[model samples]
Target: MLQRASNANQYFTHWVTAAPESRELLALCLRKLRGLNKVRIIDASFVWTEPHSKRIKVRVTVQQEAFEGAIIQQSFEVEYVVASQQCPDCAKSYTANVWRASVQVRQKVPHKRTFLYLEQLMLKHSAHKETINIKEVKDGLDFFFAQRNHAEKFVDFLSSVTPVRVKKSQALISMDIHTSTKSYKFTYSCELVPICKDDLVCLPIKLAKQIGSIFPLALCHRIGTSINLLDPNTLQTADLPSNTYWRAPFASLANATELVEFVVLDIEPLGEQSGRFFLAEATVARASDMGVNDNTYFCRTHLGAVLHPGDSVMGYHLTGTNFNDPQFQELENSSTYSSRIPDVLLVKKFYARKKKPKRNWRLKRMAKDEGELLPKKADQDRMDADYEMFLRDVEEDVEMRNTLALYKAENKKEADAMSMTETDLDDDDEVPKISMDELLEDFEDLQVGE
Candidate 1:
């Protein structure tokens, strides 16, 4: 005889095997397919009937979601057979049944409506005017000009509304420091060029901090060499009081060169600990020549921050060597060293602290629970009994006997020396030797040692 299987058999089996609740099963399935663009699940039903003496037939129908906001239907059919057999060795009778079922699952194509709607929203609500020269724009929306390729359109829009024609400009700044003389200088110049004002406004204190932090490690080797050059004996012991306004000689090279003009944006005090330090943000008149070796080189140097009269600025001599290569290499090495020491120590300490909780918590809880479980008198008696048992066990062990023998031999040597010393002291007094039988009698009268 052939037996039919229901369409819900495997589906229900998998669902039940997965979790106790249907909602959990559904959540797990959804999590598995989260990255899929479009997905649809169908409720399927099957009907089975015995068509012949040895075969069973099944018909299946499934409902699935379709693209373009419609429902899709699919169907399939299958058959199975049954046979009787006996085990060859055991002589056990058995019935064998084979069954098959066909099912069709449909998937829908992803719809493009959401993306189209977003595009429409962007076009409608976006700033219509090309150039938005607000005092400040949101950081996320500030790159609209480059992102949309609307630079020309924005400039055209700006020219029509504002009387001051929008023009691009470049700035130049130079910094120099003398270690022997302990002096520093900074000069700023501004030149008009062809760039947007949004790029110019990007200069701020945060940017200055980002640049200044790199200065210390970037010129570490140079600074170390300069410190070594100083006569240690002549080095001042007392910390010098920083001046309010320390002046250094500054030369404006931009005035002599027609390439780029620089303007001093603003100079503000960053923060004062032992000495004063300032951050200067400037606009470059020309962007083309704004590299380390170019007129803009000084802006990136250590001398960018003004120094006090006694304070020394640590930096490479930009006049003689390739400043960019050594500066970058030194920064990379310092950054690598900085990352290793702190990060490894932090991870080790974190895991060590994490591991301690298991033993610590257990000990604390055990102490608290033990206080209620055992009376003080009972605990004390138990400890005393345990200690006595331990001593007896140790005394009976063969290894412990050997250890005691070794200790006795060492003690015997010290006792023999003392006996010899006593004998030497008694040399002045005549001492008579005793017979073996008499000594044995004296030893028998002594009590046994523990």
Candidate 2:
């Protein structure tokens, strides 16, 4: 009887806040109200004493709490007591620093290309839906969540896309001694390996041999659950798992920023094939040294089918460039590995730059808080350069496009008018064009959010 009285008191206190409109609906709502126990409601009727009265008189018929199966009837009057109050969740949103969990993502690289790629992956998978706030810090982006589970899910998503190491910690926020209940703030420090696609990685000799007998110098072909490294000389590829990578961490000797433009003077197929790449010997000259010096270099590359006499390409000038890495030092000091290093390592074939280039496809970006302090001019320039390079990568690489969601441009007539020049450019087979079938029509404008 005490428990029944307690449940009835709790239920009726909030009943007037959501009273049903019609008499039948009110009776049905009363029947479903959570209070009655050891008693089954058979019928409920409501009577208004006055036409516009604020009180409702109700009679409920229920089964008695006994094996004899007696029927009992009760009548009660419910009065309206309306007051304005804020719910806990709504109040919490209005306050600051109330997040229970946070994930700090950091990459020690100089450029933001990696973050751009990560953002695209997050968008493709809809991984940031649960985040309450995303803030851009000094080195990386921070994701804030209301719960620890959401932060853990974000950490898992980061682990699946790139090679990252995570450290977890929690701080006691508040404690209740009477009930022995406590509140804690959780934080996850996630650090990504400072290597990106097309980066020239000088692997540790021992680690290189353990994963695959590929050369110590390799190119980061792609990043997924593991670091995919490809030997430019032999076209041999190896996947460095996240666990194995953390066991012996290594940094890149050079990244795409150090790439030098070279014009292909001559190329010949060596009749060797590996997937989409083919072995060939190419004679290239530095674009800067084209007219100033007649110096040309003969090096072997994997892009045999794509290279032509007049095509320009980008590669690392490894001949006289000094690297301060331990692995590079080891390779330099050892006679066995010294001869295997190439003078110029070709990264990718270059394309003609348009005077005014416009894309008919667009990528969705996450609305992130970049913090209050504005970035320095140099830092902003570097970020713009990285984003531009990433955009070019998406346009040139079909495999990359497959992993991202591309929406058709909002301006159809402008896109159609620009298509003519694109068609003309595609005729030379130098520029890559994304098929219209691959683009998704954006209907975001039609959506009405609640």
Candidate 3:
């Protein structure tokens, strides 16, 4: 069954350890019918008199056989015994190190935001469905697969979505006694790129000249297999591939910190009147500490059109080492560079945090009686009436038709199964018990009749 490529012909026996449905039983019995004089089964089905019972009565009828003769009719009954045990998937889940291959993903960033975002993408694309387990780690996520190909497939999916650097390694676990070929366990290490959106980077002079963007600085607009950089001054853009960024990684990361409220003293628009970029003279100080640095300082921003002379706006300051300095410079450039960096090279705009309406946050929860929590008696009565109406509708429950068939076969009387079931259900009467001996005698009688 495992080797078969098509599920249409697969058959599950009683050893399958789960309740086989009517379709599974029919498929099993059809295989049995094929062996009897090469019989072609016309119809095969199963029935369970007692719901939730493992015992199934399979009825089969054949319309054609290998031998030609007068029309022959036959009805046969087959019984299946199902036992309870752990399934293969459940066993793999319970066992440790059962996976053949695992993909380990990591990021150098401090936060788990990129990993969490990848998790959502994986779920949307169903990239990890074949994985035995998906675990979240402090740095990233781990995906374990029953087959090596499934792990590789998920890794490909991860690479398609994000910039991932991969390396593979294997460890010998055991050796074969006959061929002496060692069996090795495999693992793939996929590390996501460290930089992310809206980060400030101190660009290297060599890369700066190649990309033709803002010199010595750029802001990250997007992060993928390629990095998209935008010149904060000129609004120009440069997209560098992963290999290029790695080979010349002089872009020192500048973390985006908390918002700083800068009071506007003077504002002037740059270029055309319709342009978004603006030149502003503003003071630098924390929102909490409004005392120091009240004097105006030169600052450039794209949001100057919205600000008035007194309105307060927030911004993020870039902080990083100077890449052109002799201490960090690997390449020689004749042009002079600043030994000491600016106090704050640039301040990127952030959303002005709005103050929310005040309300009591810690209201005490109350305890109530169980009777109050339970459904009201009126609701219970309505539910009972609705159920009764549903029982009267035989079309809603096809199994109820079997009760009619049994009544007609035993009593030879025309009766409505829905009405009979409804009357019995409404009575709330206890079922009369029958002994094993009586059941055995009834079975014998049924056999004799057949």
Candidate 4:
């Protein structure tokens, strides 16, 4: 309700977010009056808008002395009970296997870090507000919605953030014979690209030639709708976009945990401090150092300008594994997976010495996860003040105040036109065209129209 308007007797006014319209409220009053069937209604009026009353005014004509024709009028407020009934969509929200559309979101990579980060991102964006329910699966998450268009919107959001391939399918739920209408349940499968930050991948030999790289190795640097790869030897960058990656699919070589720490032994400028990379000579710290020194490796970093000889760095090194072990395969026949990649690939440099990560992983950690991240005191105050925090906009109940105002304006104009009395004289000219009194009369006319 609005603050008291000035001159309340002349222009009754109130500010309301929503209220029952004249029809629904008036119906309740009519029903009550009809309950007393003895009364015959001659005239009834309902007033409940601008120049509005605190209560909905309803006047019904009642005959005081029957058959004598003397009548009296009685006025009362319209009233109705506010009842709650489960809507069609709300009824289905609590049941299982009742989804009109579902989205299965999964990533090819084994790590769950990307999915974890995605959860926070969606929370901030309010993406799941329209979703019926969310389920956590082994590979990723599943989203359920009441409409297929809602699922499509979520899929588009995912595609914007990650390189994903989408497949859509629908199953027929039922076909109405009389109405000749059919209903279907849709399913959207979104496959996120397996590559993530710090994962090692083996470039195809053909792709290596195409990328102008002699070594068939690259380390995943960053992932943002596309995979960013960095060459440890040359510090060269390559992008794997959603459009072209399908043609030359790279094989997953290893993860970030497979990396070993290397002590920086020597440093050299690649080209310039402002260039792409810096070169360095480093010795890999073995599990147990042998009596004789070995395992000295040539490594590269993007932050070589800030690095010194003694600074330690963590990166992936291509050492012998069971898959490529000599004992597992006869080296003589170099048939299929013969040509192996080079020694090392750089991922990141440790700006802070103590918290140096042994492996590189995409996505940052959240401080707290829930509805809000603020402290309890401040969060509670915000929750109390927010009128629409937990409320969903009901399409039918949305107040079309703009349209209502326009209608009221037009209706008032028509009312004024009809209320207008004809000129008292024969013609408008006979009314004294431009006298001082005529001018004052014109101002009065404007005030009445207003």
Best by lDDT: 2
lDDT of 4 by residue, 1-450 (tens): 122222111111222122244454444456644444766566667654444344445666554454567666554544333333333333344356677999999876645556654664675466788887777665667888988899999999999877888999987654434576777889999988777667777666556556655345667766777877776665677777776776655446776546666566667756533244565444434423333577576645565654567655567655555444232243223354354444555554433311211111111122322322333786445433221111111101122111111111121212222112122223323111112221112221244533
Candidate 2: minimum summed lDDT over ten consecutive residues — where? 1-10
Query: Please, what is the whole-model Cα lDDT of each candidate in the order they appear?
Result: 0.24, 0.77, 0.51, 0.52
**Clashing residue pairs, backbone N/CA/C < 3 A, model 3:** none
- Tens-digit lDDT string for candidate 2 (297-381): 9899988989999999999999989899999999887788988888999989998866445665677778888788577998776
| lDDT-based ranking | 2, 4, 3, 1
Give the per-residue Cα lDDT of candidate 3 at 344: 39
Residue 375 miss distance in model 3 (angstroms): 39
RMSD of 4: 27.7
Candidate 3's TM-score = 0.49
Question: Which should have the higher lDDT, number 2 or number 3?
Answer: 2
TM-score of each: 0.13, 0.75, 0.49, 0.51
Residue ranges of candidate 2 with Cα displaced over 4 Å: 1-97, 412-429, 447-450
Deviation from native of the Cα of residue 15 in model 2, angstroms = 43
